[model samples]
Target: MSYLVLARKYRPRNFGEMVGQEHVVQALTNALTQQRLHHAYLFTGTRGVGKTTVSRILAKSLNCQGADGSGGITATPCGVCQACTEIDAGRFVDYTELDAASNRGVDEVQGLLEQAVYKPVQGRFKVFMIDEVHMLTNTAFNAMLKTLEEPPEYLKFVLATTDPQKVPVTVLSRCLQFNLRPMAPETVHEHLVRVLGTEQVPAEPGALRLLARAARGSMRDALSLTDQAIAYGNGTLAEAGVRQMLGSADRGHVHRLVEALAQGDGRTVVETVEAMRDAGLSAASTLEEMTAVLQAMAVLQAVPARAAQQDAGDPDAQEAARLAALMPADETQLLYSMCLHGRAELGLAPDEYAALTMVLLRLLAFKPAAEDGATEKKTLLNPAPPAEARPPAPAPVARAEPPAVVVAPQLPEPPAPAPMPAPLAAELPPPTSAAPAVQAAGQRLPVVDAPRRPAAPTAPA
Candidate 1:
């Protein structure tokens, strides 16, 4: 027998078997139970999220007739019915599926609409399912509008698109649109466990967890990876085998890098990068893995209880919690951001490993300097010198004094003077002073003698 690929082999057969789409399932199931079925429906989501799978299940539900040929429309179809079995096998005549990606033209859409007028030949209702409906052109979309809005009572339309924005509003308005969400890692992991058990594959839980994360919320992707892991492990999955097969960088490398960042060990960080390079691991993958670890660390740090609640089998989670305790939450967030952005830089550099080495060392370069050790000593020694002082001068003494006063000597004078003249005669009588005119009448003159006064030495008179 030929080997069928895991993606096709594990495809969901019914609504109950579909994973990670409870919202769509619950709504459709309620609608069926209430008998309020819409003539046209639309399913939109990312790939592997069960858009097409749900459409098929819905088709089977609307068309299935029981083995006794007495059943009516039901949410849970009887698989024994010809319609359900044939639809599950993709060979039902009443159900038609179109890959809009290939048959997306005005002519193809008109041909599909032409079939809407005819009635169901065998099944209860004819189902027309279009996959990737966003690929249709504007003209094709225009062709689909009228039939989609008012289809024949015996016909149902199911349209699926990975990108809904590309589908026209005219087309969107005619159908009841439902969005399917991507599965969480935990949901994907649980589903994988159920699948592995049914396949009788021996696997470690750690290996399965790794596969779940690698799937990134796509069950089809998870199962495909699981098949590859099982084959690599020869039907028994081991963590080492799975990691080696996926070329997954070891989480220990991430732990060491983060611990070095927390402890401010630049040398250890460089050494860790060198070790990763020696082990032949991709630098981009290392940074990506480290970022994942740091994110987990931040979560555990924010909610301390999560540290205790982690699965011990995942050494990475334990390491994340440990690093979270050692590093500040702010630093954890910073390093996580750096690691994520650094992955893009790896390809731009000439050597990716070297670029990765620089990225690892970048955190050490940014580590804040220590503040308390050597700066305090210089301020204490060698005090300022004292100001200078001068001496005072000596006081003066008193001297002896002299006593009393003394007299000085004098000098003498000399000589005589001329005598004065009288009025008439020197010695006339004192009674009458003669007049000089009478004496002068006679011409010749009378020489008047001076009335002499005695000149002598001066005396006290």
Candidate 2:
């Protein structure tokens, strides 16, 4: 018998098996029980967040039959029925799943829509499930708008996409939309524990926590990673193995680095980074770990009681709280921002370890001085002035008066006449008869003269 992977083997068969999507499940369950079904349904979310799974479960709900083969539309499908079994196996005649990513042209869409007129061949309803529906072309979308908006009573449409924004508003308006949120780490962790228990695989709690955080809220990814971890650990998942597999820095190192940074201990910071590098740990991962610790420290600093209550059982939480108290709130925030942005700098540098060292040192370089240290800094920057060699103040001098001279009045100078062109000078009239020359001795009249024109006549002769 061929072995099925955990993701496929444990795929949810009905709404009851779905996880991390209570809001969606409740809404759908109520709608199903009341028979308030829409012609078109759109499920949107990130990858592996149950978009496709929800679509399959919805299809089974529409077509499920009881063991005795006498069932109507139901919120819970009987997996034993031919309709439910075939749909789960992906071989149902009426439940058609189209991968829009590959067959996104108008011809394919029209071909699929061509079947909308026909009745169901083997089930109560004909379900057309289109995955990654956003990949469909504009023309393809337009091709099915009329049918999607007004489908037959026996026909239903299920569209799923990671990016709902790419889907045209026209198509979006024709469907009932449900956003499936990413599962929380805690949710993923609980699910993994159940899954590993079923598989009879022994995994440490710390290892599971690491996997959950690494999964970043994807159940499918968490399971896939568990499969890899089990194989790597030879069926036993341990913290050290998972850490090495993930190239994650140890919490001890992260805590040490944070403490060193808080205390302005550069040597410890450098040593911690070197140890991480020696262990072949990722620089980016180190920064990521520091950012996480700093973030926790910040939260604990901000709301100590609440954070304590939330992280009461976490082994590292106590240490985080300790560091939170040790470092000032402002410095914690500053380091958090630096570590967050420092990850981007790792790729730009030639050596990632060296870059990590620089990023850590950068926080120390910019760390705010303490109150006592501020005074010391001021003294260093501006020392006291010398006292013995101070210069003496000078005496004020007496004012003196200048000697008086005999009075001698002077007359104002006369104004100069303006020059004129020779031709204009020749054409000028004599001084005005109305004016009296030398009426005032200080005012003098100036004469003007024009150049001779005799040379012109001599050349002609």
Error of 2 at 450 (Å): 50
Q: Write candidate 1's Cα lDDT for 414-453 as tens digits.
A: 2343443454336554533433443223244345465555
Question: Could you say which candidate leads in lDDT?
Answer: 2
Q: Give the clashing residue pairs of candidate 2, or none.
A: none
lDDT tens digits, residues 332-389, model 2?
Answer: 9889899899899999999999889999999888876668546122234656457876
* TM-score: model 2 vs. ground truth: 0.81
Q: How far off is residue 263 in model 1, in Å?
A: 1.6
Quote model 1's TM-score: 0.79
